[model samples]
Target: MAGVELLTGRAGASASALALETAATRHPGALTRIALIGNPNSGKTSLFNQLTGLNQKVGNFPGVTVDRKTGVSQLTPQLRAEIIDLPGTYSLYPKSLDEKVITDLLYDRGSAQYPDFVVITADASNLRRNLLLFTQLADLGLPAVLALNMMDVAEQHGVHIDIAALQQELGVPIIPMNARKGIGIAALKIVMAQMLGAPTVHFYEPEDELLPMIRQIRYYFNLHNDYLALHYAHQYRHIGFLSPDDRAYIQELTEKYGFEPTARQAQETIDRYTLINHILLNAVEVTRTERNEPYSNRLDRVLTHKVWGYLIFFAVLFLLFQAVFAWASYPMELIDEGVAWINSLIQTNFNGPLVSLLTEGVLAGLGGVLIFIPQIALLFAFIAVLEETGYMARVTFMMDRIMRKFGLNGKSVVPLISGVACAVPAIMSARTIENWKDRIITIFVTPLMSCSARIPVYTVLIGLVVPDVPVLGIFNLRGVALMGLYLLGFFAAILSAWAMKFLLKTTERSYFIMEFPVYRWPRWKNVGLTIVEKVKTFVFQAGKVILAISILLWVLATYGPPGKQEGAEQQVRTERQRLEQAQPAATHTPTENTFADETERLVASAKLENSYAGMFGHVLEPVIRPLGFDWKIGIALITSFAAREVFVGTISTIYSVGQDATQQTVQQKLSAERDEQGNPFFTPARAMSLLVFYVFAMQCMSTLAATYRETKGWKWPLLQLIYMTGLAYVSSLLVYQAMV
Candidate 1:
């Protein structure tokens, strides 16, 4: 028996790889653009990394928000090439947004980023199914090399391929590669650098019943190849090159030729496979030996077991949250102390009304955003490890049964879990789901899950409510509480999804079919890069919002009705004079005294009360008082709309103005806050109420922007905002009233 290749079979591999010893290798300067295209999990990215390491940029496609990655590969050190890595697609026939993005990028010859050549990656183990995409690319008449990746896995399963024979049959150079181990990467680079920008050659000349209509479209559209024209007939609705009139013309032809989309796609797929099978018969061989199921299967059997799978997943989550608190605390403290030093330095050197803005508005706002980097990085690191090691797929598989009940496919699980890091990208990730309703529902509820932006809010309030005592002598009570917050989000998402199912009506059928890649050791480089990139992106993106809003808020907090500031100053002066005069001669101390400290505090407090921002907060106080919020909390709540974590910066700036802005930490100032009655403002009941409020509220502008982009309308984003805000209000009201 031959070695097994999934979706097909393999026995062993034998061939002399291209060494690039040919005189054609000339390293003069930069080479032209080459696109790396492949099916999902085909190791194309790994090969790209092998070609270009640490020299990549992440941006968006023109006029679209899809992620685009381009890196430079040093083919021969001097013969460098710009490699564009397109998103993974199952086929050129677009079923999802990502697939549409790939097609738009490659098919538009007018675009600047169009590739001169392409490298089509096919998984050797899954050769039959992977070939479907390769065949489509070949039909476009772009010169391409086929990289059969994961050859080690194929050989291990006793799958054998005659590489030279397959190369001849396909009418293209074939390279066997194991990207994970850097096998045959040099050979791939040689072939890519050699043949790029040369004449366009195709591997397959597909014959179809639709040829007559295709020829008509080609003549009308002036297309280069019959298949290119045929694809216009196949997916003109999504092809960006086609205009409304063009699509209408294609539609007319479709009816004229009796073209059926499903039937044609099925026939083309079968024909391609039939053609591929013929090539495989003489070019491939398989020899099977006595071997039990692979180790990954054995692990999946236990890890994805009905009973144990759920339990193990929860246990992993528990440890993840617990570690966030433990590991991030040290860095957070350092950041806090550093901010305090900067605040003190500004007070000593700078004077006047603007001094407070620099210290509280800029430095404090930046600190608030930066302080959470450790926690954010840790969360993303865990997520990356799970993803890189292939455990995340299993998690999705385990959650699918439940996801279906809520009108979502297992694919929703990835986006929902990623929401814990940040909702903007999480909602963007939902585009992977083929169904619009599922994607929209996932976007609506993803914010309900506490993102990294909410961590500062949750942790700050948790300090005021939950103790740091150990639970069951193992888990910290605070850690358990945080985990509970995340769990609440998951529950809310599913319940909301279930309700929305009845609201949204669509004709598109939903399906869940995914291949669970074999588990492997986590790639540490990818893990580190993910953590750094995520943390950097979060900080800088958040810093921009925090900076602009902080300055505006400072202005709001500094000025008041002209007479009010003057009156407050007079009152502070009079109080200070009275205190100084009352002090006995023997107790007099000009430099430092308790009376001085007391006087300064009173002055700051009075100034804050009379500020314009204070008046607004006071006006809104009654509205939120039922939920255990004060005037300052009211201001923070309003500003949090910029970003949930902006709540921290808003509160920091406000509290710093009212107290000793230079000395105390934001948390310390918050802890010392009092009401008119002299009771703690952040009472456990009040803190818990706020936590519940943030947990359910959609207080992120970025998330709303992404939702609008993905859904392409304001209706869904507005509805999401309204629903989440209403839920937050009622829930926080109930909790605060009950606890108080």
Candidate 2:
């Protein structure tokens, strides 16, 4: 306790002084490292954004794909700080992947993220439950601040805390602020700046009975403190860095000492709660004020109703789809025009295969991907609004009962919701579902959700069949079609989950516990950032795959086996000449009967059909033909396995190269395409068939790889790929045959 000294006994100043002392003693860098910790719904993300603005990015913690958001915050003019927003957790005891990341980072002295200071955020309205995490972090004795977020909601509840008394009892600066309103931020920064060079202090300790065992662990690990050693003692077996030898020794010592970590954790929680309740007796006051039950609770009555709730959700989804079609039309058209212009410009400048590569491969690929941006942006924007308003939690609550019927736990809703963004992260999020069977089932079916990756594919194909006409005088029928595709996916996921549920069995009980926050107006700033971040991630991440595949496809389409292209133009000209001459002189004029442009396109097609990728496509054509796919589409199917988003780019590259240099867009080129018999290649039946095919196909390798990592075996991902592919083939076949 040498580094700790109260600035004023039972007063407010000691909290600031302690932080300052801790920083002075231990602040080791020019940029003070601050770690943000909080419970779910405490507005930690909002606070992080307020602190760092757009200067933040999401990255993976070392060796784990769990997202770690880090950013730089200028706490004050004098203090520069780096902030890491740790995932929310209730305690140091790990239950999920995210929780494990926190426990591992905080307890490991060797970690770069083992912070010099911590900012523990809590919801003022749910102070009792939120404080459980705050008290646990305080025990680590790092220089820390307690931010009572959402003060407005607390005021509405007639809840008040004596900030001075809480500061004295908790021995941390108590900053009561509404993160959404930016209230108290300046004062919090000023206090944080003052504590930039403070020393760390021990504010909480274990019982005398456990101190002996903690000391032994500290000595054995050569650790700096008892808190770190105690964590190691409890979780040695699960600790990634601990050797088998280390785990064996810890196991032996714990058994010999008759130490029970679970029992110890239970006792600690009770003792801490007792201490906390006593402190609150002096530090907090509650009126038990009578007010209308929270709006969230009232709204949940209608929103979570068994029948009406579902109808409302579908209505919302239909509205979302209609917006995608309505709002995105103008922008999508502009994108198509821009791409056509670029393709025309590039095609005019270059010659031979090089011209095709630039115009057809690169520019066309770019055009296909960019056209979907508006639709993607709109989709995520609506989702963001839903999330910010807390409607999504209600969706989760309603869906939980349905999930239980499918062998999934309530927590599966998180992964399924996340899957809409991207399946890779969604599968990673599934780690939070503790039951092995439930987590595996969630992972298997998450990709079936209509991810943003599928937006381009769906919009492109759906437009071929579903017109943009308004339905019921207000809604876009095309949007209804899009929603139908999504519903198809959802139902497919449910059925898949049911099948897997019957196949995989576990002995552990399933449970779902969650707290819902009172509804608030959407934070527009956060909503904009959410959409921007999601769209940016999509463009850049998908761009890499598209670019690589486009280049490879260009090479495959441009080059052929020796002499393959030789006489191809001559052969096309010979056929056109014979046909033109055979027609009566009175039948047509020279220009009218000419097929020069068509002949050039035919030659290009013939050469491509014999080229490397085309030859491979021909090999796949027979396999995929029953699903209404030709050789060109077969090539796209093969490349789409790398990423489902690549389908548009693949089609763009394939069609653009074989097409005449007529400055047409990819969609126009596709629409104008014909079968060998001169019928439209993409009839409504074929379009619907392909759309159904993509909806069920497990086309992304990354999702499969993520599943492998999550399940620690290939069995699940392999089964997933097979099941989805089979479903896709059979569904597409039936649709195409019935429609034809």
Candidate 3:
């Protein structure tokens, strides 16, 4: 099976040979690679999802923040294809790091894998702007096809486009498509297959007037910077090349040619615009009225109003959090019960050290983290809806006013909201903010948003201690308390941002320049894709950490120093023999049965005390004695560092290991547990203290890793870890001291 190769431009002979060899060795004719390029909001991704379904992966471009999405699709029974969704950009001329990635990949100047064939997705509603990019690609003389996307929208708006005429003018196949509705995909795929074996086609030649300008720019470019001139010339010859560097060269040439750089660049831009404008003038005709009504502006009136906007946004956020608890609670309970049942089934069916390890250690530990998927999925679902509907942009626009007071950009809203899901992605999302100071401040404060990782700890503690009383008429006290924790995080973030503003001095002008993409109905396909990707990420990323920790925890709780195992067995045997000897043959009546039960209890108690987990707990008793924590709780806390949800699993495992009877339930065992003084270990006060501890603790390593990657150094991550951990310790200490 031959695997697909992504070539940006026509690969050099040596590179081509190497790629072909690798593909042949890897999988002969088993793979096909396709590239999807489009102007922003052209529904390219929708089409990608429709084609690839769930078989996709998202990764970062080499040394850049842009996302590289690749997926496999079956175009025919005999043809399998790999599709790459390129970053959304207005033009090929790069302005941001993300745009540069697309340009570099197309030009084969960077490490980006090039596509075998380019699928140019153009929005029919905004064909003029879309065509500017399309024209540039066609000029590059590549084997390309055009996807005239959102044709339904164009028809509804009474815009007419001559597909045949357009194709003839551009010298490429054009397939009118409504990607959202899955229209014209079959034809597009057929065209792609047909063009795979076709020769490269050039669309248009430079005009006489533009030719002189191009030559003059190339001359200056060659004179001032020979390397850059040669680079662009090579790209121009092979890849469809248009870049900021080209524009810069042109501007510099104008300076030498007796014109201002700004004026000349502006003129060049306008000239290109004029040419595109004339082409569209001939190719398209609009019958609909030119309406001045911008949908975003109209929605913004209510969504981003001075007074009502903030109130509405906060109210929506509150509802979202409340729903995360209320709506997801039933599903969460189901998941928990399901896991518990499975554990019970496993224990009943098998009896051995390996079985015990598998059930109590691995399954139980993983269940702790997996059980929270419902809530995380719900949170992401709501976020996806908001984003797809364009409500999130309004959120940024409205929040910008408030965030500016604390010296943060409105764009920080995305990161802040993302933090609720997981601080790692939220931190990474901060790259979208253009200003350096704003980005840093956003990064610093993003972790303060109560992440989903903390929810497990919060939920366990809240259930254990917080009363389920009505606060006002409708509010639950427990829910209100949870809300307060979230608010505390939010306020802390604001305070941090303010402090950073004062400490870090930079004169980067903060601007609220964001495209308010036209509102559209939420595409279920896109929403589903987002949810699947996010949940998959959570499971795999967090699962690896939890699995490792669970194994280690199993070892620590299983093995003890010296002859502990032998001693425990000996104690159990002695207690059993003593009980058996005490039971007289004639005295085995109803009262005798009670006596025998008491004897069995004693034997079980002796076995537990001498067991591995019990002995280990006793050793750590001195260390956690001050904080109202026993050794079992200490172990739970340690495992919680992998993920907060593991607290429940750790406790369950510890209790089950000590009991030796796999049939015993965690809740039953927990309820019956006693401390050294023969009192219940989990008092209301102690549970509250534990809850407070978890609420503030920085226990998750993944969050720290993400923060490090986002901040580009350890300074921020280290500070976050130290500060959050310190706060957790101090807060827990104070709570326990006050309570006890």
lDDT of 3 by residue, 379-439 (tens): 7777778878878777877778778899797888867875776665566557557666788
RMSD of 1: 6.8
Candidate 3: C-alpha lDDT: 0.68
Estimate the lDDT of model 1.
0.76
Give all TM-scores, in the order shown.
Answer: 0.81, 0.81, 0.71
Q: Give the CA lDDT, 0 to 100, for residue 344 in model 1.
A: 97
Error of 3 at 216 (Å): 15
Q: What does the lDDT read for residue 621 in candidate 2?
A: 91
lDDT of each: 0.76, 0.75, 0.68
Error of 2 at 540 (Å): 2.5
Candidate 2 structure quality by residue, lDDT tens digits, 441-504? 8998998987767888988887777788999999999899988988898888888899888788
